[model samples]
Target: MNPGASYQTELAQKLQCFFSDQQQGLDIPPAQLYRIEGFIEAGLLAGFITELGLKQTLVDSAKQYLNVEVADFYQQDYRLILHMRMHEAPVYPSSNPPCPQS
Candidate 1:
């Protein structure tokens, strides 16, 4: 089989096994399961990386392009950098309070 097909099959099997194990004892609804699966798939595609690791890697590659040092760096390492930047950004509170619900 082609690499892409093989990867898809593997991913499917992993998702099946994961949901089956999760449902063994607990009562989880289908909608919840679907949502959880979406999160899992997203993480698999673009997941978190340790801040220390990312920093060290960047420091090591400061003089050169990261892609030159690591093949497919854009596919994974770049995402980590973006994730870190987004998460580390400062959040400011709104001046106005939220409207009270009836």
Candidate 2:
């Protein structure tokens, strides 16, 4: 048996248990359930990281980055950070392109 098999099994159990608990407590409509289902992974990952004893600052920072889609959908600050990270320009660009330096 692979040495990491136990760890994998434990993680799977935790994911299932976490998902099940959320599924029970949530009260969303059936029509929206499929779409809402995808976001659960972000919460699950954050929970797993916390359970593994990662530092709170690191966990919060990583979760904020990882769930940027959710943040953008909800109009949160991470959307701006995500846009800045994605930009190819070294400096922030305005509506007009930067003028070449002499």
Candidate 3:
């Protein structure tokens, strides 16, 4: 499958997982579940980085550049950064266990 379809499938699966507690009486409709799942995934990813990462100044700077609220979507745009090796080197230093590819 193409990237778009794969993303959609992954998103759907995430929604189902996030809402597995159908019995919890959440103020969420199953139809709007994808939005919640996406939010959870983004929040969890950000929390992981903040809680376990290298705590580097550059990363904090990068997050600001991207706007903290949606920083989770800011993968190092190698094309935009130009400094290739410099960019990749941060990958190892940025997280304790390494950043996950979502």
Candidate 4:
């Protein structure tokens, strides 16, 4: 297994537990529970992304083409960089898609 995978999974689980405990202490109405859940899930996702350090890796790998040094790279918001990279990933069509034969 990848090292980052384990770290991300552990971090997400820990954050979820923390948020769950907070939810228990809150007296929010049923209608607001969904909002809390969404917030928790988003926090977990962002935390996971940060813990993975994929953005750092991407920056390190592109140092030459990007004309940026390691020290300078640290000055940027790598989390947002990773988010943009993920957003730009290709999306394949689902209908009649190619698949490996069983």
Question: Which candidate leads in TM-score?
Answer: 4
The C-alpha TM-scores of every prediction are: 0.27, 0.26, 0.24, 0.28
Residue 89 lDDT in model 2?
28
Across 1-84, the per-residue lDDT of candidate 4 in tens digits comes to 675467556544543443343334433344444554464355457554543354454454435323364325544753423211
* lDDT over C-alpha atoms for residue 83 of model 3: 14
Compared with the true structure, all predictions reach lDDT values of 0.43, 0.38, 0.38, 0.44
lDDT, model 4, position 69: 49
lDDT of 2 by residue, 20-42 (tens): 43334543344444433333334
State which candidate, 3 or 4, has the greater TM-score.
Answer: 4
C-alpha RMSD in Å of predicted model 2 compared with the true structure: 15.4
Question: What is the C-alpha local distance difference test score of candidate 4?
Answer: 0.44
Better of 1 and 2 by TM-score: 1
Q: Any idea what lDDT model 1 has?
A: 0.43
Q: Report how far off residue 56 is in candidate 1 (Å).
A: 36
| RMSD in order of candidates | 15.1, 15.4, 19.4, 16.5
For candidate 2, the lDDT comes to: 0.38
True lDDT of residue 91, candidate 1:
82
